[model samples]
Target: MRPLPGLAAASVLLWGCGPAAPRMAATPVPEASATAGVSSALRPTAGASAEPEPIPAGRASPPERYDDGVDVLHYDIELALPRGSGWMQGHAALDLRLDRAVTAVDLDFSGLHIDEVTVDSGPVEWHHEDGLLSIPLGSPAEAGARHRIAVAYRGVPDDGLILGETVHGDPSAFVDNWPNRTRFWLPSVDHPSDKATARFTVHAPAEWDVIANGRAAGPPVPTPPEVPGPSVGERRTWIYETAVDHPTYTLVVGGADMVIDTVGLAACGEAPVSPRADGCVAVTTWLFPDSRAEGASSFRRAADMVDVFTDMIGPFPYEKLANVQSATRFGGMENSSAIFYSQQAIAAGRDIESTVSHEIAHQWFGDSVTEADWSELWLSEGFATYFGAVYFERVDGMESFRERLAGAARAYLTSADTLRPVIDRRGDLFDMLNRNSYQKGGWVLHMLRREVGDDAFFAAIRAYYARYRDATATTDDLRAVFEEVADRDLARFFGQWLRAPGYPVLSVSTRDLRTGLRVEIEQVQGDYAPRFHIPVDVEVTWDGRSVRATVPLEGAGGVWIVPGAPADARVTLDPDGWLLHRLHGSPPSP
Candidate 1:
């Protein structure tokens, strides 16, 4: 889904929406650094089977609009796509948990030309209106009661499931329901807050490959006469089911004529069919055979990247990870286990690590550890951006990682329209994808790492990921985890960085004493911006030797005394680019 400005998945040559935006040229990655303190993330005892701890509830109340009477638990959908007519037929069955007594259920729906509705295997009264469908249950279900609602519909979803032609001119169909477009095809509570397990039985021409969110539920099973299945053509129904619950936005379907690359990740597990298996993950890549060489070149490092991230985080979190090369509204869409990439990103001999890594990172951040509300978009975008930078730091040098953050900081500072906090409350969906959510968000995490040493930072990351995995989290939820790990309140730290609008601007003046140097750093921000509490790394040079150490600076201004050998000693502030603020006095610093 689009953050603020609408972001494509990832890439240097590829910004957010692939082919939608062009950015800087691509940079090659170096080999990963030797494992140091972060290896604890991959503790052998902490496998994928390690149960996720219950995440603490957010301090804020759940948004009223999202607290619908019915909570969707599972979805079983059957859809049939015919050749030219843009029209389609479908039947959706939803297992729901009732939160309150209700004679009617409301679901977000745009256009489906519904035919009928059924509840408890019987006919029910229903009405379709502007952006919603009201289904009368006839009898109100009591709180805590479980019920099933089914809807049969036939119409065209020309705006939802994106259909186009690939380079080989093959008909390609991919899901692009970022923000809120799922309603165009499925009749259900289409909010991210309403998560559910899903099973899809898609009917298309036998020649086209059908893929969905979960693992393949065996070969094409014959349509059953026990229910209303796709009868649009002589089609075989391919069924897929998810073992883990997921937001509707991450639900995906990719159908096309393409080649496949299968690589087994024998560490994560198999599809829930054999719930007792070794939990191995299957990695499959889909691309047109004509472009197979280039696609192969672009995905050569897929396995390596998986190993790197798994080592840095916990075990891989899905039954399988499918990398599909397709025509998308975005360069990449992290649709749970299946990640769709733009056909345009495929270049001979060059792997699109930026996009791939970002999407894979989402398997941990966005997909599993989802944001509670759209306002906490940084938890998804920022986490992906920074983790991508961290991946670059591992594979590329520290300079490359610094360049990425500096570029993000520059983009954030230079943007004239950026004034909102990183935890933006704007109702507009596209407003969540701006530089503040992406680049500067990365800087926030980067600086946080500097604040808490690397060991604690990575541990906190794994802790947060594992704790919130398969659940929704807020910015407050994340800050709580970090604070607990860092053993500090961090109220001021997160407040000034996330709630405040801009970064700090400092002006420094140094005084040379007979024995050492006294340095005064001033916050030059006129108003509106906050004076950050940051640890400024200072360097003191005197008579051919230099000493470096971090000096804690708090509030509007502060002074630090440097123990030195002479008064003529030169003093420097922030010798390394550890903080995301501007310096403007005495010796220049980055």
Candidate 2:
């Protein structure tokens, strides 16, 4: 992945590197009522009344989308990796269509040493500088034209692809490109906004197995290339093809002593037969040979996860699924058909099942229909995190799911003071991978599902996936889909949660009056501009009877008449986890 120009390139520190804590952070059950959407209403704290200024255009620029005059059709990349040198030579053939007349084509490329460049099988004037490769077309290419730029280059990518060594001196490597790290390795329009179908022909030493983004098109064919002197070792070339259109970030290459195997799709659960799709979807695993047994055991129910998500959305969108235990910086990266997991987390076997589920969820959200820009990354990361919980509930019980949601809420709330909105674009690209994107993003989805009924929510998800499969989308795109399915205007609902900073902190007060229980809800968030227009539920309990009712709580504050309750009743705000916030009660305010 390519970091924005001048921005430092850094990978997410793995759980292994961070403080030793539970992979999923969830504190013990705290004060229950106060934890859910209620906080200190009158606490002395500074508040900003003005709306957070919309992210400035040049503050955090979205990645370049140069699809105006030319658009990439497909990429056939032939990569040759010589063992031990950490260097790779590549020959890339980029098929493109000219949408309009173009005198030049700009491609994102960095680090690689270019040997030769051609346009439509002929020599072309080319310039490579500061990560952008500019190729002049001699004269303006006609509109609706077709051309292919073939490039021969070689270099060692320091960032996107890393050669990591295990404690036992086993040479291992993985590609860890999130946000915009693809340009540090492969060349093309590296932004998620410009995606293309890809084919990979990879060469690695015979001892190390090669893994790419897609399923293997055929068996590994040996290619004994002529070297200048004595060759280092026996090398082989593997062919893989992914017809699915995905962002460059999903393209990956890893070589390790990993054992690959297949498990039945029925293992995930009852596999749903896609009407237009044929064949039983196969679940595959790539793990280090030493830990093959435990790694395979850890990923046992991956097939079930596939079925669970497919049943929830639509059919499995990719060719097949491969869970690779790699040396990736992230705990797990959902790279199209091939998902890479950190070896450290895999060895521990903690949260392995849920991690696998998370990556598989991305096959639909992140890989098939990608986020149009980094600002909308929650559409990918958050969806994966939420669906992982869904799978957790399916495999475990409701308690586990509740625990997961509670964990996410806790993580988000703890970071609330320093939190940015889900659709933030003002900071570095890496900032998009924060608690907001993973946990809070999931909470937003959970709340949306609660806002619309389960039927409508699922329908919206299926429709969204069906409409955008093999394409790219944005936060507005998803909001529109949800509104269309639910048939309700959800602009405020999305805006307050997605664009607003911090979260709703409600101060609750209830009186058991004769005319039902009088309940008051107030929004006391750190920011005053966002008065969350959300559905609130007031739960009342007295004399072994409990009742829950929806009350109007759309902004600063609102008084509600809770029916079917005695005057003297204990009221709990949002008893069923519909709203994500901290709740606190006031002592009648003097």
lDDT of each: 0.70, 0.72
Worst 10 residues of 2 by lDDT: 36-45
Each model's Cα RMSD? 11.3, 13.8
lDDT of 2 at 296: 61
TM for every model, in the order presented, reads: 0.83, 0.84
lDDT of 1 at 236: 48
Q: Report the number of the highest-TM-score candidate.
A: 2
Q: Once model 1 is optimally superposed onto the true structure by TM-score, how far is the C-alpha of residue 301 displaced, in angstroms?
A: 2.1
Off by over 4 Å in 2: 1-68, 227-230, 266-278, 416-419, 512-516, 562-568, 585-590
Candidate 1 C-alpha lDDT tens digits along 270-322 = 22322336655666677655555666655655666666677787777676788
For candidate 2, lDDT tens digit of each residue in 436-542? 88888899899999989999999999999999988999888999999999999999889888887777788887777776778888888665447778788888788
